[model samples]
Target: MPIDHFHKFLTSAQQEEITLEAAHARLTHFAGRPWLFFPEFSAYVTSFVNAMRNPVAVAPVDASLPLSQYFIKSSHNTYLTGNQFSSKSSIDAYILPLLAGCRSVEIDVLDYKNEPYVYHGYTFTSRIPFKLVLQVIRKYAFVTSDFPLTLSLETHCKAPQQIKMAQYMRDVLGELLVTESLDAEVMDLPSPEQLSRRILIKNKAAAAHDPNSTRPLPDAERHHSAQSSSDGTNSSMPEAKGGPSSSILSKKVKFVSDLAQLNVYHQGSRLPKLPRSSDSPDLGPFQPHFDQIFSLPENKLASYQNDFDRLVRITSTNIIRTFPKYTRVFSGNYNPLSFWAVGSQMVALNYQSFDFHTQMNQALFHPGNRAGYLLKPD
Candidate 1:
C-alpha cells in the first residue's frame, strides 16, 4: 500500500472506532450502566467492535441459490396483539411484523358478514375485516423490505367468501401480487432476487374447517380472542362448521383450485402429507405438540440424532417453517436457536413478545441491508 493511502486507511479506521465507541456510550447511557464503560476499554474494543460491525458472511448469498437455502424472519398469528382468548386484533398487527422485516406473516381467515375476516378461528380472538388487513399489508409490504413476503393463510371461508378474498387480495396488493413465473429454476423455490416486491400466499386452499375447531380455546383464551374483536359478536365459541374432527384437510370448500393457483410461489402444511419431492410444498416446524404427533417419538429433531441431521440436509435443499407451540396462550415465543440449529429457515416467532426469542431474532437480522432473507450456513 502507498504511504498516503495507508495514512488515509488509518484515519478511516479511527473514525469508525470513534463512531462505535459513541454508540456504545449511548447504549449504556440509556441502559443506566455507565459504570460498565471505561477509557482503557476503547484501545482494545475498537478492533473487535469494528469487526462486529462488519461480520464475515456466514454463507454465500446472491441471485444464484434457491430461496429454500436461507434463514427467514417470520411471525405467527400476526394479528393478535394480546393473549389467545380475549386479546385484540388490528391492522396494525400486520404493520408491526412487516416493519420489523418479517418475510412471512400469518393471517387466520374466516367468513364473517358475507366477507372475509382475519383472526383466530373458534376462539374469541377479535376479527378485523380481511380487506383492512390487506390494506395494511399493501402499504407496509415493501416499505421496509423489497424482498418477497409470504402470507400464511388459514382459511375458514365458503366458496363465495374465498373468491372475495382472492379479488380483494389482488386489488389491495395490486402489482405486488405475483401471478406467475416467480422462480428462475423449474424445480425449486425462487431466490429472493427473483420475487422482489412480490407477495405469495400460503394455504391449503378449499379448506372449510379450522384445525382446532374440536378443541375450543379455553374460556381464558376465548376471552382474549373475544376482546380482540370489538363488537364481541363471537363472545362465545362459534359453532364449528363441521361436526367431527375429520381435520381441516378433508373439509373441502369451493374455489379450492382458484385459491391454489394464487399461491404460486409458496404453500404451507402441518405435516408431510405430500410425498418428498421438489414439487411438494414447505411442511411446518409444527408447534411442539403437533410436531410430536406428526414427527413421531424417535423422529423428533432434538430427541433423535438422525432427525437433526435430516433437518439440516432437508433445509439445505427445501424451505421449512418452524413455529411456536399453540399452547402458548400468553403470546409467548419459542427459542428460535433450536429451530435454526436444525436448519429451519423460518423460525416463526411471536413478534408481540419481547422474550429471549425476539432478542435473538433482532440480533440475527440487525445487520443493515433491507433484504429480509438471511443466507443459512452451507
Candidate 2:
C-alpha cells in the first residue's frame, strides 16, 4: 500500500511525517515483502517500527445483574425482509438477526387451517409456518450469544392452533424453552447468567377464571360479536380489526393452557396510564407486576417521558419494550437513544433496514462482549 493511503487510515496522532527509511522498515516488519531484502535499501531500513494502537479498553460485560437493569438488543418484525406492507416473510429473516446478536424478536402468529403461521397479519406480507420459524430460531438463537432470548409472541390463533403453537415450541425448542422460573422464591427477576441458553415466551396469560381450559370468556364473546360485525360474517377465526400496527386488541381471545403456561417470566400486558400529578401519593396501581412486560408504541414513549419518575419506577422492576410506529411502511427506524435514555430495556428496531438509527443500534451493542445485553448507566 502507498504511504499516503496508509496515512489516511491512521488516527490523527499517528499521521506525522514518516521518513523513507522508517516507512520501509515498518512495511517490512508488518508485511514481510520479499523485495525489502534488496541490499540497496538495507542500510536505510531499521528493525524497530512505531505503530498506533487503540487507546480505549473494552470492559467485560457483567451478566450477573438483574435482567431488567440491562438494555437488550432487540428486533421488530423479525420475519420481514423488506417493506413492511408487501415483503416476503422468510425464516432467514429470523436467522440473520439471531446470528447478529439480537436477543429479542417478535413473532406475529395467526391461524391457517389447523396450524398456526407467522406473518404480519392484515398485510400483503407472505407467511411462514409457525413450526418452521421455531425450528429456525432453535438452530440459530445461540450462535452469537448465550444470553437468554425473549420471543414476543402476538398470537391471533384460535384454540386448536394455539395448542399446536405451544406444542411446536415445546418440541422444537426442547429444554431451551423456559417453562418455569429458575428461582421462584426470589423477589427480583433472574439474571441473564442464570437464564443463559434459554428462551422466554412473552405473551398474554390465560384468564384466571379458566386458566386450564380453552373455554371462551364473556369478554371473548363480546369481541366475537364486534369482530363479526366488522367483517360482516361469522368467521370462526375472526380477523383482528384495526390498523396493522395496533396490538392484539382482542382481550376476549381464549388462550389455551398449553400456550399460557409457556409465559413463565415475561407476561405481555398493556401499559397502564401514568399518574397525572407528579406528587400523587400512590403509585401502587400504576406499577406493573414483576414478571410483566409492557410493549409501548414509539409515539407513546413521549407520554411516559412526561412522567419520567413513574416510567423509571415501572422499568426498575419490570421490562419495557418500545417498537416502531405504525406508519413506517418503508422499514425506517426511530432513534433508539431516546427510549434507552428513559431506561427502556428493549428499544426494538427494524433490523432489515440499515438506516442511521439501526447503525447506531449496531454500534451500541458492539461493546460489552456483544452479548446482546448491556448494563444501563446508573
Candidate 3:
C-alpha cells in the first residue's frame, strides 16, 4: 500500500508523530521480510492511532452543588422488557440500565394478592415481585455509578401493602435507602456528592397531619389525576370506564406514612405554571420548593417552549423531570435534548429503545466517568 494511503487514515496529530522519515524507516526495516502480512501493517497503523485529538480528563464529578443543577441520566418505565402495552416485565430491565449508568428509574407499584407488585397498571404487562425488584436494584444500583439512584415510585396500593413496600425497601436495601434529609435546617436540596451511594424515594408524601389515613391527599391526588388526563393511564387509579379491570382500577389508594416518610429529597409533585417573568415577585401557588420535584410529560413540557426563560429559572433552583408522552405505547423515546436544553434535571427515556434519541442519551452521559450526572452548562 502507498504510504500516502496510510497517512490519510492518521489524524493530524498522529501524522506529526509518525513523520515521513519515520514511516520510510519503518518500511525499509520490513522490506527484506519474505511475508508482508496485513497484521504487520495493521499493527503499524494501530500504533499511530489516537482515539481523540483532545480527550476529556477522567476526573471526579463536582457534585457539591444542589441536585437540581445537574442533568440526571434517567429511565422511564424501567421494568418493561418491551412495548408499554403487553411486554413482559423482568428484573433484567432494571439491571441493564443501572449497569449502563442510569441514575433514575421508574417503578409503578400495584397491589397483587394483597402484596406489592411492580408492573405497568391497566395493561397486560407481566408482574415481578416487588421484593425481588428491590433486591435486584440493591445488587446493581451502584454497579456503574455511585452518585445516587432516584426511584420514581408510582404507588397504587392500599396502606397495608404500602407499609410492606416500605419494609421491603428497608429490609432488602438496608442502609442504601435514604430515610431522612441529610440536613434538617438547610433549605436547599442535598448534592449528589453528599448523597453518594444512597437511594432516593421520589413518591408523593402523605399529608403531614395524617400519615396513615386512607383519605386522598389533595397534592398527591391532583398530580396523579393530571398525569392520567395527559397520559391516558392513571398513575394511581383510573376512572371507572366499565370493564373487567374497572373494579380494580377504580380503587383509590394512597402511599402509607411508612413509604411517604422515606421520601427525602425527591418529593414528586405537580408543577404549577411558571411566573410570567423571571423577576416576578409572586411565585404561583404551586411553585415547587427545594425538596420537591416537578414531574411533567414530554408533551406538556413542549408546550412551554415559548416560555424558555421562565423554564430555565424554575430548573435552576428546582428539579424538573420530563418523561416520554403517553401516546408512545411502543416504548418509543422522545428527544431528551429539548428538555435538557432548558435545564431540566431528569429527562427520563425508555431504555428498551435503542433509537436515535436513546443513542444521544448514552452519548451525553458517557462523560464524567459515566457517573450518571452531568452539570448543566451555564
Candidate 4:
C-alpha cells in the first residue's frame, strides 16, 4: 500500500496496458482479492482486455481475396476535430486516426486564397491549408502501420485547384500513391497485400454531359456500372455520374478529365443500391446521418431488423462505412461493435473522442499487428 509504488503503476499504465503477470507479481503481497484495495491495479487483467489484445485464433486472415473483401477502417469528416459545423479543422484529425490504424481518411477540399483548403462545406467550420494537411499525412502516413491509406476527399475546389489537388498528391505521396492494381482486368478488388503502402483517392468522377444535354444520362444510367468497393480501375473506364444538378457538375467534369488522364484508381461517386457479395469492383454504401434515421443500435435492431440483416449480407462481402449521426453535436461516438456485428467494415468513428466505439475500434485492430485492415467473418 505504499504511495510510491502506486505512482509508478499509474505512470506505466499511461504508456501501455499493464500485463497480468506484472500485476500479479506486484500484488503478490496481498492475501486475496487484491483488486478490492487497488481496483485500478487489479492482480488480473480482465478477459475483455486480453481478447482485445489478441483477436485472431487458428484461422488466419485470407489475403488472397481482393481489397474490398475485408472491412476497411474509414473516417468521415476527418479534418474537423469538433461538431458538424463551426469546428476548428486541424491536421490532428488525420493524425489521430492514422495513428489508430484507420485506413480511410476524409478531406473536405475547398477553394481558398487561390489555393486549396479543407473544411466542411456550407458550414462555419474553419479551414486548414490543404498543402499543410497533405504534408502532415505524408509525414505520418505509415506511422502506425505500413498499410495503404485511403483519402476520401470531398472536393469543392474549382477546376484549377482540383488540378492542383492532383498535382500536390502526386508530389507529396510519390510512389506511395496507387493509380492502378497489378491485375486491372479482373474487375474485382485487389487484396490488401496487393495494395500495401499505397494511397487510394475516393472522389466523385467528373460528369461527361455538357450540363444541358437533351438526353443526359438518367440517375440509373449515371451509376449503371457497379463501381468497385475499392472502386473502378481502368476496367475500361466506364462513363461517370448522375443527372445534371448544377454548373458545378461541369466544373467537376473539367477536373475529373484531368484525373482520368492520370489513371486514378478509385473514382468516388453516388452509388444506387447496396452492392451484392462479389470479387468484382462494386459500389460500397456510406450512410451519413445514420443515427438520426435509425437512432442507436438497439432501436435499429428492434425496428429495422430486416434491414440489419440486409446490412450484414452486404457487409459480409463488401465494405460499408457508416458515419456518426449529425445529432451528436459534442463529437460523441457510438459503440462500433453493433455495426461490426452486422459486418460493416469502415464504421467511421470519431477518434477525437475516446468513446466506447473508438475503444472497440482500437481493440479490433489492436490484434494482428495493427495493420489497420481486418477480415470480416465468413
State TM-scores per candidate.
0.65, 0.76, 0.75, 0.66
lDDT of 3 by residue, 1-378 (tens): 555544444426354567655555555443322222343354333221223444367677789999988999999989998998899999878876775678999898888998999988878999999999999899878855779999988787877898899999999999999987788889788899999999998876443344463434445345534544465543344223233444665565565667877877776665545557555534454444577677888888898886887788778888888888767888899988889999999999998888899988877876535588998897
lDDT of each: 0.59, 0.73, 0.74, 0.57
Rank by lDDT, descending?
3, 2, 1, 4
| Candidate 1 C-alpha lDDT tens digits along 348-375 | 7776787887877867875654356887
Deviating ranges (above 4 Å) for candidate 2: 1-57, 210-251, 280-282
In candidate 1 the C-alpha lDDT for residue 335 amounts to 72
Query: lDDT tens digits, residues 1-378, model 2?
Result: 455444433335456666655655655544344132222122112111231332235786788988899999999989998988899998878866775678999998987767899988778999999999999899878866889999988788888998899899999999999997788688688999999999999886454444564424334233433443455432222123236534444435677788887888776655645558768535543444577677877888777667777777777888999988878888899999888887899999997788899988877886424478998988
lDDT of 4 by residue, 48-154 (tens): 22243544543444566755556777766788877766788887667666655678887878788999998765568898988888898887677556667778666
lDDT of 2: 0.73
Which candidate has the top score in lDDT? 3
Clashing pairs in 4: 67-190, 188-279, 188-280, 203-268, 204-268, 227-282, 228-231, 228-281, 228-282
Worst-scoring 10-residue span by lDDT in model 4: 288-297
